[model samples]
Target: MSILSGILITLIFLGIFISPIIGIIAGPKIQWNNQMKDSCEYFDTRISMGTHFPESQYNIRSLDQSVHDQTFFLAPVFAPQADITAKYQYYHRFSGNTANTAHLAIDVDLENAIWRMMELDGPDERTKWAAVGRKRDNAALPAFENVNQTVIYNGTIEQLGPHLWIPDFMMLIQGIDDARQHCEIEPFIRVFDVQGAPIEYYESLIQPKWNWSPEWDEYLMMRTASFGLGRQRLDMCVRENNFRTFEFEEDKYKGVSDISFVPLAIIASYRMRFSEIGRLDCSKDIMDKARDMI
Candidate 1:
């Protein structure tokens, strides 16, 4: 064969070899980029933060001075009927008395999520891990929409039956709902449709506060969550990995002791809303878990 003919033949063979390899590396890179974009846009907006920092914001001070704790408060509570769902109306928002104490419930559609777990997609940014699948834990949910097929078909959860995703904090929320049903006078309760993200991009969406800890200041979060102006410190969940060293394990700096401030924020807000309901103890288990954390 002539020199030009051999060169041409080699070029053709190389193209065939390299094409699939390029695809193999590029495919995940492309998906990763898309996920980053989605997570970025989702967190940057008020969708995630509005669960606490509302948009149509009526002052928590409410133009009422008897209520304290408003110095540096950033996570002001959204009024019960405000347009919290301005971006998506799939949810039903309403508030009324369960017996005498104020009771607020916002039943989320269970089909949308802030991160979406790469499962369902839509306009709402709720913690809608329900309807994703129906496990015995979630039989109360509506018919299975199979919103998230990835987890159900994956053998690990197959035997557990179709499982739904409920955040750890909802245990407290649900327990509060029960306490309101039977207890005497209790602080008002609001079941937020919100998931755990913030107004800024974080490394993990699944974690409380999306694991946004910038330093080893969980103690700061605990102290701040109870104070009006201090609640902004509650914006972090688990301590950053860099803080998870010998000191953290030995309790020098504290580990996940404050498992999450999400619960504390809920409880503290209840105390604020009902100034008389001091030491709000609706859910014993949850309150115990959050006692020191709050």
Candidate 2:
């Protein structure tokens, strides 16, 4: 090929490669920067607080009290309830402990038969009993732990339940007046999209209806407060993409630990049914901008 032809080809290739870069750097307008700015403002206006909850409370328990009497407790482990509006108000009024009112409980149904079996001779004995005296001296017998290891083992239930019960044997074993006294908190974060919409607004569309336990009140409060703070932090990021921000202070409560005050931004996407397109699109755009800023 001639020298001129070679030079022409190289120039064309270079232009093709560098054109996009130049466009990105010097385009008439890229909406991302403006979008980010708007997102930050949106989050700032939306977020009202920041808070933390423990990691244990997110497990949902079945509400059926009747399920406990059977040999196998029937239920499913699922996401903790995120509704805080009603529970928070009730806790604030009744318990006077507002910091953790938004919490949810980890419900585990204790089978009466399993509880009785465990009490009769401890876990090892229960394992032997399950073996029907065939493996009384089996080495594996001592290794068995929990009701799951017994003959009539049932799965764990982690969903919201109506009535939570602690088997009498469990109360005696744990030295607690009732199983209801043992509450757990799950770790969760609540934030707003850059457009100032609360995360709970998104959650409520998909979550199930369940009753709240007094034990979960504090968890709920912290989660609600975090959503508020997340809104603020998201706002700050949108305004100044390079700037760093964080929660100023976080308060602690009984049974809650390892509180985090770091700044965070999250991007999530969900396919909305055609009927729900309008709201989803608006919310998704706001969330996308917030994510970019972060």
Task: Please provide TM-scores, in order, for all candidate models, with all chains considered together.
Answer: 0.19, 0.16
Q: Pick the candidate with the highest TM-score.
A: 1
Runs of candidate 2 exceeding 4 Å displacement: 1-87, 90-258, 261-294
| CA RMSD of all predictions | 23.9, 21.0
lDDT of 2 by residue, 46-66 (tens): 222111111111112112332
lDDT of 1 by residue, 78-185 (tens): 233356555223422211111111222222222132111111222121222221223236446444333221211110001011111234322122223222332322
Flag regions of model 1 displaced more than 4 Å.
1-84, 87-174, 181-258, 270-294
In model 1, where is the ten-residue run with the lowest total lDDT? 151-160
Pick the lDDT winner: 1
> So what's the TM-score on candidate 2?
0.16
What overall lDDT, based on C-alpha atoms, would model 2 receive against the true structure?
A: 0.23
